[model samples]
Target chain A: MRDRLSFYILRESPIHRMNPLTKLTLVFSLILLAFLGPVEWLAILLFTTVILPLSFLAHVGREFLSATARLLLPVIGFLFVMQSIFLPGGGTALVQVWVLDITLENVNIAFVNATRILTMISSFLLLLLTTHPSALMSDLARRGVPGPISYTVTSTLQILPQMQVKAATIMDAQRARGLETQGNLMKRIRALLPLVAPLVFGSLVDVEERAIAIEARAFNSPRQKTSLVEIDDRPIDRRIRWGLILVVIFLLGSRLWLK
Target chain B: MAQVTINNLTYTYPLTEEPALREISIEIQAGEFLAVIGANGAGKTTLCYTLSGFIPHFFRGELQGKILIDGLDTANSKLYEIVEKVGLAFQNPFNQISGSKFTVYEEIAFGLENLGLPRDEIRSRVEWILALTGIEDLAERSPYALSGGQQQKVALASILVMKPGVLVLDEPTSQLDPIGTREVFQVIRSLAHSGQTIILAEHKMEWIAEFADRVLVLDKGEIVRLGTPQQVLSDINLLSSGIGLSRYTRVAHRVNQQKLWPKGQRYPISLQEATEAFGRLLSQEGGSKK
Candidate 1:
């Protein structure tokens, strides 16, 4: 609610100044290239040379690195563990522990898969870090995405923080009334019902009112809508979008040739 | 001619046995500030929704009668069509937020944007309304970051920017603190003075006594009393009906019970009137003693 619920960083940079649709295209293109490029190390190469450098250009390098290490590394680590150990039917076993076997070929495939996933998520994360949700929704709506679809996405972004705040308040109030949330796992699980019931029921009541509110504002009116905050889409932004598409196609073509 | 006419209006919510409004009839003319006062479960909020065309359209309940606002029947028209003529801002300020925009300026422009107005006109209208509601400095701030009063003002400005003929406010300050209530009331007072047609339901009696042109008292979903503020607020039966009276009116009522007030003089409903009435009585008694 402060600026947005997403990872958007407010900064003045070329990436921040680009159109939201262009940044969106760039995100999908990066993801496509990471998954379909010919080289086995293509995911790692894109992460280092493309995504990391672009985060700096977007003036969010520190946030990008810290968030990646904090939020994504654990999942990737778990994936690598499972894939290297339980992965069957390939290559020589480098290590054998108890009943599990870890193989060099399996480890290599796991590393590549993990890096590809990292590249995919980071590309979308970069887009989120640079673009506001409203700007993205507005651009999509203008491009003939139905108004309700865009509205649902943007409203969900806004309401999520509010619901969390409400949940916290409910938890605090219940705790003050001698409802224990810190104890055995069973006790904590039991505490969740008291906390969640009010949050959910209270929010349900608000839904009717919010619907009436939006209707009052002519949200369902059948007409071409306008936007207040003007999003800029210069000639360069369009050219960049086309360039990203071509790169995605090239990556796909190379992947086919290799196969 | 932003007149609101409700005739024989009896409405029940969906799946409810008892009607929320019972055979209600009221006509509000253009540029009139009508204040509706009642206790909890007294049908005041229901009346506000009915006037704003949400009863038959949005709620889709069984509405026995018809409501006409600005010559358009509420039952026959779509809510989007009725909304252009009537705007409603209800009790909870947070719920009234459209939840679709980020900044206060865009929030105000949301309605105009949906209505397909030109960009320049929408900008000017939003700017003027921001200043009008005294929230020009908050234009760039996130709507969710605002205080309750500030958010309510933003809600009000969001509606007023649409230029609806009739504005219906249901306890817009109910969720605010004293200072916040005053801030919102100040904006509403200005809107009242500017000849806007307003229907307000409130529990605060002092502001109603001071600013409202006409007052309607509802009890058990029926119109019990309807008159000017002085006539309705100063009624002796108002205290017994559970709808609170202003402090000035209560004091005057006490004085009348003591047989000190003049036999035929009307009881005062506001502080200024109460002071003048007592002052006149005191001077007259002093002159007779001399």
Candidate 2:
């Protein structure tokens, strides 16, 4: 059922071989750069060449772009309106739409903002897809992250599909009880109530239970946790991680001094 | 010999006024297969949980007395350490697994890895368990893709990979259909044959009659009877009282009523045994007529 998810994750490719920390660092750097860059198409263009290709390089393929666009499209509409309508100034007033003016200044701002949003979302998607959640959790813990925080982060990915299944189980069970989710809005909500309530309640209970499951698995042991997908401290991997940190510093320097 | 001693154990769910279990005490051997049976609200599930360290730990409740697993009190031991000795594959097979990205193979390895076995050892043990459960082919497939029966096997395999000596189940096949039920029993049969201590709480007594070594009848959170299958099924009134009689035994019971067989004698636990016993009686009657 989830075969493709398993297939794509935990593979021994060079990208998967790199440390998740390194990937996390790089993605954070990319998002920071995207945030700090000038609201000019040229900066977006320059960043896209460096940042966007990393998704493909990490083996997510063309579907990566579609996934990013899918996630960003709804976000873009809200941000676009904000930049267009709520901007402090306008180069030239083009038209009035409702309470806001459409101006060339707003148009330029919207484009830059949308591109930046897409950049952040895409970089995150690329990094997470290559690294399994357990490995990521282990890496975070080894880096001195607290167990509860790391557990909350990793186990959601672990527990989400379980909740998803629980929801479907509820749906099927409710259907058998003669509830129709495909009906009117009220009926759909009514039908959904049985599914949602139990799932939420069950998940709340599961959090407590999973807390023990984690502890029972030695998660609370004072000894350090070892990842099954152990990343050797390769020179190349170290260099890449240090390199990303340096890039973030360089960009921070550029943003401060070059302005 | 390792033994589980329950001394004056009583449990009450926090919101409820009535105690689910009342002053229950029983002892089970280290590698014993004890099948507990009772009607709904009979406290059968509660007994299983309390005995296996899930009652006070996982479920919030007022628990009285102590549950000692192999002389180690559950109250004193950590759940993870206890879990290493006792594994529960929950009845809802799907929710029991921790991660979905793991294939059938990785699902089995998940718990084993947590137990900190060496890598090669984990590999061989996973392979061994997949074959032991007879799901080696399904190793590479996602857990979501398998049928209810196959997923249950994968779930069992995952728990078994840790090689926990005792396995407890709460109506493992209740969710499955007839065929799935049969397949689940087949896996359980093999596990029992391999000498794993199996504690199954089931309402379906026919399969339990054929498979279980000992039957513990729980009625209102008390052990009413503990005996061999032949000894327990022999009494019609006792069987119906709360023991959850098997289908074949019920049939044998009906026949006994028609003929009024010898009183206080044993009842049949299986169809074949019933047929043989009835056949012997019929042959004796014919010989007397001749």
Candidate 3:
């Protein structure tokens, strides 16, 4: 269920116990380095080496690799077919459907681009596999984010499951009205209009009623709203927090000094 | 003492052919509980909206005449001012709760904080309302995690914390079970006892009969009758044909028509009264059940 997405353990290890703010900062910094820093193949290889163990420690290394294969296979196949036929850098024409020439340059460019996308996606997915939404929000709040803003983000996260329930309720209501969602594709697609119309209308009605209820409850009336579930920063959290900060500093420092 | 006053009021829907309310007039005194009863098309909800200043203001209807709250004209009052005077607990509790807090304590504080009370004051008021509604044990628990009855109590506590002059409920306990109904009735009773004018629009007439001092029967957009509980329930002809009557009244009527016992007052509402009235017969006849 989408509700349980927050609880998935990509890997159960000591690293997962690190303070979420620390993990978040580290992941974001790594993403920045990959995207904005030098395009050295060694750096990319090093990033992948660190991420593989993290994936394995999170117990999702197999899933992580298979997912990469699933996404990259088609992209690699398309690149091969196109580059071998028309691209100027495929070394020699390996295949020609008509007048197209496949070359080594196009093959190399596609390979680099596909690898870049795959690595970025895998790293992000691994981050989600190990982090909880509530923990993430608590980290966001502690870093000077306003309570209401954080609450809005957290509640929005919490509401995804509720939206699923609302959608189910709408589907059931439509089914009761004789609109079959389980029918043939065209039939179901046509049936969707009636389903969508009421859901949107009912959601709008709920939004108004909810707004009135919110007004009555005086949600925006208070200047400061306190969070109930406070996250504890253990010693494990502290060490990881410090370690992540040091790595960010060293990487950026080396980038300038080595230059 | 009239917490709410209506004078020669008429409201028609924006595009409808007929008026939703026609020259309706009534005065609800402070601390008095009034129940509005009607069929599906009786305009019970419309009348509440009209008095609360939602009609013509929120709903954009044709309004003629005046509706007042403690002598303040509601026709042109801002919604916030109206909300200060009248707190409406809408029909559905789930849709009525707006905050995303887990605890009932936070929910109760919602309105007081809106009133711009100091943090200490908000804390005290939240604590007071929590105990007042007997939901202190539920303070830490998530409201979305509660049952219908508990959720309704949270909703009531949330509104009651504001201490509005009048509380308007639109079938608040309709979706609740019998036990939940009893819990809601207790809250309403406490609110009324504290001198808050409570307006209950409900279909459950038996509890309403026991709780409210007065009744207003609306039929097809017109105020058919309005009076004290006894005055409304004692009318045999009016009670039978009226759109909404407590189930007990119809049963009492059935028992009254049996003629097995002599009718003196001609109406019985409570189970104790029905039993006590027949106790004399049991004693006189020396009747003993096997």
Candidate 4:
């Protein structure tokens, strides 16, 4: 596992410098369009024309494509296979493998669903790639998000990597002690107990000290909080956000009219 | 009046029968470097927490008596309010990190931002503390990527930028290596020379001998010995309470036991004093005639 919590690549690209909330707005707009638009090709079109080009503009195109391939493809692939095999509404069968029949209608439905998920997850990945987690969190807090909530989100992102490192260490130690991890399901399941017990309890112990540490920094201070890094939310950023909102509204209206 | 006055302060954690601290009273004057020494579980950390208002406030335990820091009653004030006057750094540098910041510079500014300082002021203070703590080179580095010593320095700098009236450190160098410990102690020594009121709990007697204006030895939640470094660190009875004496003091004890030293002589708690005493002994024995 990677030690860092974020996929943020530091660069001087304009997309990387865009307001974090504006990037977030772009993400939500793409997802909404993919899910609510009454067109099958819209998902792939958005992914190709907008999301792919945005990644290149952000200077994280390579990172974004690899992240999507590594993290999102398997889940979407599994969903496509399950939906094609189990979907019973289609009339014309396209293929038959033993008792499982694949039909043209179900394939179409599954293909659209898969594309929609790809667009949704790719949009999120794009945002994650371009914007740092702390920058996103600080922007959110500035926009009326609660301090503790932002703290929780950013801290969770950090804590997960540390926990994974801990788990890996325990697994390595247990393996050195000759605890079998690669074998039948029962042996592998047995290895999890030794690895998990220490990780869970150790983190639980750290939670108290971490809480006190943050409290010592005045985490619950009643004063108006100030930020050290001044994020630029230019007029264009606000206009873009407004534009994204309008697009979302249009998508919802079109869906309602078609219904 | 003293900057910190704890009067008969006793505390017991929630869901526990035994009190972690009992009848502890100490007065620390302004600009004093007071060091607390004790064996593990002897309430050194508990006392540090109480000093920083975490004992009764953050821990939610039963606290008795009063802890007055810079004239604010910690028992009545909220944790946030007390934190403005007292900043605490604990043993584990990793745990002390706020974990919400990407750069060490922002991490140091976490406290000031919470205090609502303007951005320019925050920037100036953060930069100043980064230099003060000797971490300017690490300003742009990720906090998670720092070494143990660097993280501890960042933790110390984070608390120091808030400019609290008193700084409480519960063995800040306990988890560091020798070089790391030296680096942290150098920064702390500089802070002490600048006359910052510090209440530190540590077992490194040599460092305490060099920097602390006063030494406190606790045993079973009570102050067993409290005095100047030379007085308390050289006390033979300190070992009986499970507190380790400085290396110089240990040698002094050994030389005194062998009757090689003059009678009624003061024990040495530092290398300089030991060297002086040994020099006097050598001259008295005519060994300096060469």
Cα displacement (angstroms), candidate 1, residue B35, comes to 1.0
Candidate 4 residue-wise lDDT, A1-259, digit = tens: 2336688788889888899999999998899899887677899999999999999988888999999999878998898899989977757888898988898888888889988999999999899888888889989998889999999998888778877778999999999999999999999998999988998898888998899989999999999898877789999999999999998898778878998
Candidate 1 per-residue lDDT over residues B1-290, each given as its tens digit? 43989889999999999999999998899999999999889999999899888888888778998899988998999889999999999888998888878889889999998998989999999999989999999998988999999999999999999999999999999999999999999999999999999999999999998899899998889999999998898887887778888888888889888888888888888889988998998998899899
Model 4 docking tier (incorrect/acceptable/medium/high)? medium
> Per-residue error at A80 for model 3, in Å?
11
Give the CAPRI class of candidate 1.
high
- Per-residue lDDT tens digits of candidate 4, residues B169-207? 999999999999999999999999898999999999889
Worst 10 residues of 3 chain A by lDDT: A1-10
On a 0 to 1 TM-score scale, where does candidate 1 land against the true structure?
0.96
* DockQ of model 2 vs. true complex: 0.33
lDDT of 2 by residue, A100-129 (tens): 788988878898878777777777777767
Candidate 1 vs candidate 3: the TM-score winner is 1
The candidate 1 chain B region of ten consecutive residues with least summed lDDT is B233-242
What CA RMSD would you report for each candidate? 1.8, 3.6, 6.2, 1.9
Looking at model 2 chain A, report the run of 10 residues with the lowest lDDT sum: A1-10
Pairs with steric clashes in candidate 4: none
Q: After superposition, how far is residue A62 of candidate 1 from its true place, in Å?
A: 2.0
Which pairs in model 1 have colliding backbones? none
**Model 1: per-residue Cα lDDT over A1-259, one tens digit each:** 5554778888999999999999888888877778777786988999999999999999999999888887789999999999999877867889888988798999999999999999988888888988988889988888889888998998888888998888999999999999999999999999999998898899999999999899999999998988776889999999999988888888789778877
| Native-to-model Cα distance after best TM-score fit, residue A92 in candidate 3, in Å | 8.2
